[model samples]
Target: MQVGIFQTQEAAADYAAAHIIDVVGGATDPVLGVATGSTPLKLYERLRAAHAAGTFTLAGKKAIALDEYVGIADDHPERYRNVLRTELVGEDKTGLTDELLFTPDSSAPDPQAAAARYDEQIRALGGATIQILGIGSDGHIAFNEPGGSLVSRTHVDVLTAQTRTDNARFFDGDLAKVPTESISQGLGTIMEAKEIILLAFGEGKARAVKELVEGAVSAKWPATVLQMHPKVTVLVDEAAASQLELADFYTERWNARH
Candidate 1:
């Protein structure tokens, strides 16, 4: 794992965007696995800015969503698909076509089968160049809550109380409206990516960031699984890196690289 401690969120976003652009520039046909949530919003914005500046483009790129709430309507504003559309795929952003942006339909006749098929689609596309992830407050990645099986494949999983509470902010504070389950790409599925870029910000994420960067690999903290990946870049602002004991070492290493 390579940890980058940026002075501000924008700086971190900019730094992360550079790596993503590099992947796009080199790949013959780039495919990305994207996660939804506030943590990655700034990174998506930075990518959009790069597109506007003519530094990069998503015209021929394909993407797969990391997860989706199990019972939401496709058009629901809070649905992960719609959120990605409005935030990253619309007019001036990623500009990815509907055919290239693969997201599971929660209302499908056979949801589990849909998930399995989604995984196969990713495999057929030659896997993701780099998956962009946002760590949940409880250390969950995508919707794989704490204690989830590390080698599990794409499937349905129950959302933990902590995860629902964290996601309730997107449902207009109505915790009751938050879905109890979600179809998420498993840790095993996520590990298939050629590389992973994870972002975290604010004091709320400090403990999770600390565990992800330094703690032992355990199902209890799903993000710890990244420690086993061959390539990973963890970007966090100072507040989020506060609990990491090796923060200074990471900083010095990153500084020397420049």
Candidate 2:
């Protein structure tokens, strides 16, 4: 596990964007496992901007979402499908194409079948060339909430009221309308990625970031599983590094490593 603390959001976004482009630029079929949340918005914009300038490119790319609301229609404005389309794949005339996408739609016969098929589809990219993540206040990755089996596979997960509320803003101020369940890639699956880059922003994420990076590894904080991965990068702005006890040390150490 490696961590980098930056003084500004721009610095953090540039670091993440460069790593993602480096990973995608070299892969034959880069399978990007995407997340939907406020933290990654800037990173997406940076990637789009870089692609336009020819600083990086994702030609012939493919991807699968980290998760999606299980009971929601794909047309739902807040679904991960829609978020990915708007954020990451939105650049007009880019090499990123619709043909390279796969999502969990309501057409699945059941949540289990949908999950199984999703896993098979993702296995095609040498298993996620790069995966972008957002940490839960409770430290979840994807929707693999705490206490879930680390080796679990894709399946429907009942959302805690907190999870629902956290995601409700995208639904235009309707927490109650947020889906109660989600189809997510299991912790075990996400850990299979060749490279993982988890981003957290804002002061609100400080504690969660501290716990996942410097605290004990525990299922109760699902993101703690990152410590066990062969390759992982935790990128954050100063606001999100506020509670880290060795915040100064991390800054020095990360600068040296990078």
Which candidate achieves the best TM-score against the true structure? 1
Give the alpha carbon lDDT tens digit for every residue of 112-145 in model 2. 7888888777775567888889998878889988
TM-score for predicted model 1 compared with the true structure: 0.97
Clashing pairs in 2: none
Off by over 4 Å in 1: none
Q: Which tens-of-lDDT digit does each residue in 30-64 have in candidate 1?
A: 88888898988888888888888888888878988
lDDT of 2: 0.81
With a 3 Å backbone cut-off (N, CA, C), the pairs that clash in candidate 1 are none
Q: TM-scores of all models?
A: 0.97, 0.94
Error of 1 at 184 (Å): 0.4
Q: Which ten residues in a row have the lowest lDDT in candidate 2?
A: 88-97
What lDDT does the true structure give each of the candidates? 0.89, 0.81
